[model samples]
Target chain A: MSSPSRQPLLEVRNLRVEFFGRRGRLLALDDVSFHIDPGEVLGVVGESGAGKSLTGASIIGLLEPPGRISGGEILLEGKRIDNLPYEELRRIRGRQIGAIFQDPLTSLNPLYRVGEQIVETIRTHLPMSEQQARKRGIELLQEVGIPSAAERFDHYPHQFSGGMRQRVVIALALCAEPKLIIADEPTTALDVSIQAQIITLLKRLCRDHGTAVMLVTHDMGVIAETADRVAVMYAGRIAEIGPVQDVVKRARHPYTHGLMGAIPEMGADIDKLTQIEGAMPRLNSIPPGCAFNPRCPSAFDRCREEKPYLLPVERSQVACWLYDETGARREAAHG
Target chain B: MIAFILRRLAQAVLVMLTVAFIAFAMFNFVGDPINNMVGQDTSLQDREALRQSLGLNDPLVLRFGRFVANAAQGEFGVSFRLAEPVSRLILNALPATMELAIVAALLAVIFGVMLGVYTGLYPNRWLSRFFLTISLIGVSLPTFLIGILLILVFAVLLGLLPSFGRGEVVRIGWWSTGFLTWSGIKALILPSITLGLFQMTLIMRLVRSEMLEVMRTDYIKFARARGLTNRAINFGHALKNTLVPVITITGLQLGAIIAFAIITETVFQWPGMGLLFIQSVQFADIPVMAAYLILVAVIFVVINLIVDLLYFAVDPRLRIDGGRSGH
Candidate 1:
């Protein structure tokens, strides 16, 4: 493993995911790249079909059958993990890296008690007696703010409420003290009030344990509230990557700007909330030059003809042909 | 749970009563048992006297009541065919049939569950296809045909096993070696295998389908996501969930096995209840027929009751109190 100080905890370089759909092989993740530092939360925000969840699943090595990583180097502390055998990958998964899924109900095994599930996960990677594991399981449950943890240990998953079940799921994920945790829309399945509580609990727990998190959700509000940095995905590529405040306050890429505008502001006088003008292009029908060029407001001749690479901008990165030299000159003259 | 048990017990009683009433009505409406008992050469006066002596001259309702009372106390009058107490006749043959059915059911469940789990875990693979082919053949081949084939190959051709009978019914200190003898059990193998073949196939297919369906549940995926080995995921989690339905079908099949045992007994001539039933039916022994019908009804009811109770044990969610608590 690379030293914590010198290397990012998890890094993806030139990652490309494809699926063998009925039409043909379709690219799902086009050269997606990002790095997550230790003890940081990188929130990925995009509408459905933007490949946000796929990115998270790919990183955790849990993509379902038929969808696969085509070309990529997913480095866990500078060691490539994309090509690892399933058994070896499984060892790294749930132990070195934890995952919290969207649905709390389905995430747990209904047959087992919540505490037993936690102990099973803990004992899988750690050497501990049943009694010791049980003790630790109770402690983790209490840490996640489940009341009467010892008493609740014997109750099955269905006995718990939705918010409580999500807590149990989080406890299961944290049982092995993994370095990186991938939470894919963890709060979406929850009620509005419970959603805030869980988000707060997760942020606090991750901070206390120094665990890096990849929080994936379509809710920009959640990203603004909980994420340290935000990666804005459009179609299959990262259109913008920067600190949450900067990205939310001043987005550079046109797609990112449209996404920010689409967020319903509090106390707005508008009759209806703004929506993005066009639908996400079909995976097979992705445009030639830029995947988002058709939806982008600042599409130029070059934007239609040549794809834009993610290039460094002020304190972040933006992929837009309008940021090129000629386009910049036009903007400067207008300013 | 107690309420559920009580409800099931009430249903069992109703079913048994219905079966007894049908048996009684059918037996009385068919013909006189006395006429069958007395030969054609007997005088009309002698026949009348015999009918009066056997209480066949009594009212049909009264005779039916008497028969039911006697059956409840384990008496079934005298079998016209066997010429002995129907209870003793049943007792003599019951063990052999019970032994055969028990062993066959046990073997079917064990082998069927093994094959089913294997096939379900690796579906569309060679092992699955092989088991599927064997199951198809088992289902198509009739039990008597299988029995004859086995006897031809193993007994006549190889001379390895006894072809028929419970092998001399050896006396051993108060315990008769009816089924304990090697030759007696060896004779049982072919018939039991034939009797169990279709049941085994049915059970295997049910278990395989249930297991495959359960394996696709999210909990199984969750188990896999926990990094559990394939064996642990397949057996510990998936198989346990599949067992409730498998067990239910097994209980139902067991009842069918009892009914099918009559045909199997005649084919093998194993001197079990089925053969007794056949002989009684041929002679028109009404009391014996009623007794056997009641016994079969009791067995079916008891098995179903046990299965109902087992459902609660297997899935805690099925407990009546558990359901009520949800509301």
Candidate 2:
């Protein structure tokens, strides 16, 4: 997945998102960059307000007012999409990049039949007649595991349970068979047991459809189970990005290390789970040097003054001075 | 669906019966109808004979039963003032009031929903702001004052419309319609606006707020994310959701238009039920007064029933979940 020779399906380069408020301009996401390869699941794991969802929203061109991408080049298959006009961007939205939000209860319009919504989306991007779209809608519904797809087609969103509605949403997102699907906390609102079902459904769908996905969530357990690569976001910046196994087993960034440590392991002998000491910083008052420096256990003099961008560290790209020459030499001497 | 409607109809019947009882009660407090019908010089024998013939001498419950029976047969005795059948007077005035109300309601709903959606979609646009400001005036101004102002501008200044009355109505059997004749249509313009302005503004404001609220919902965001065109997203997705509330307000407002067209009728001297009711009040015409109150109640009941049915049609959640096997 990290093979640089192949062109990525989606590339977000040095993305910066800012909010204009009464207090003046505040940077929400600064220089956040990552890529998702075709048919790959790139998990974006972060705490709330970590710009995980914001990144997805920005990519899909649905950022609410006063929050905008101030600086970034969002290239979809080598074409710039960040600067496209609304009409053009809309044409690209479901046709090339689809989105799935957190709550299935509120995601589908309650007034429309689940089938009608799917059919409408299909017809919007594809040159299909209503009947054709409807047929495809039923097939897609079946594909997403909705029981009795044809019968469920006429049912309202309220008729479906939370998990079923999410399946309908996933069916809707995949209507046009877009290159990528942005699942923003798709299972966060589902039951713990149903969450695994949805995750499995999502994983199988992506594989079958060959659709790349930007899986944004705070659940590391979900990320570990489903994602091929994972990017750990800390205060609107990518603290680490690499193969999921490497990032989870050998987290190069301290924030990623602290994050992985916090997750409780089954059958472990520890009495208390590892907990990060400080809260994530707010946008207006994020620390000057590295946004995570205040909370970093290895923070030294230089770490407090200069921000570190993504640098190659083993198999992962880490944003920490601990991976630099001095730190490496110190580690060598200690070893 | 049939059961829902049947239940609503049963409720409406209950409501209408209750209104009829209240109307019946009004006759006792409104003074004797015989006194207004007869002269002071009439002998006691003659007065007694008239009362006996009219069923006034009967027991109260029996008289009420007869009254209810007559009312069910569409016979509301005779008006004390006009000395004609109460049903005929209302029938004659019914067309005028109904025409005025329907026209006003059409104007209100059409323009109200349009302006509301426009303002909700683009709250900062200059035209939207202008509509909003105009709505504020519409909502704040009294109906009579609005009617008078409309007459002043269109009738007095421009001399383009009739200041009073239903002009040149064409008779089509029992129904006299203002829709066919040109002068009749022109005559309707000022009074309808006067009658409907408040309701129009109310509907517009409700729709605008509802549209704004619906536009911000997660479904709307998902609709946009799904690449539906702006028009489809706003009107199809957002507007459809706004309709359940809009229908409720618009329905109630329509009933208000018919019931409260009194001021507009008085200002314009339109030959409608409102004007007839006012005249009946002046003359202490108990029969006509009671009939008018009952009619208004019926209108309210029917409109409310319609509103409830519209809800069932518009919102699937309100419908009993018919078919499903949930896992």
Which parts of model 2 are misplaced by more than 4 Å? A1-5, A326-335
Candidate achieving the largest TM-score: 2
Clashing pairs in 2: none
Q: Over the full model, what C-alpha lDDT does candidate 2 score relative to the true structure?
A: 0.91
Query: Compared to the true structure, candidate 1 yields what TM-score?
Result: 0.90
Q: How many residue pairs clash in each candidate?
A: 0, 0
Model 1 misses residue A335 by how many Å?
25
Distance from true location, Cα of A54 in model 1, Å:
2.5
Top candidate on DockQ is: 2
lDDT by residue for model 2 (A1-335), tens: 34656889999999999999988998989999998889999999999999999999999999997999999799998889999999999999999999999999899998889988998999999999999999999999999998789998998888899999999999999999999999999999999989999999999999999999999999999999999999999888999999999999988888898999999999999999888888999988899889998988989866788888899877789999877887658657877
DockQ of all predictions against the true structure, Cα-based: 0.35, 0.69
- The lDDT leader among the candidates is 2
Q: What share of the true interface contacts does each candidate keep?
A: 0.24, 0.76
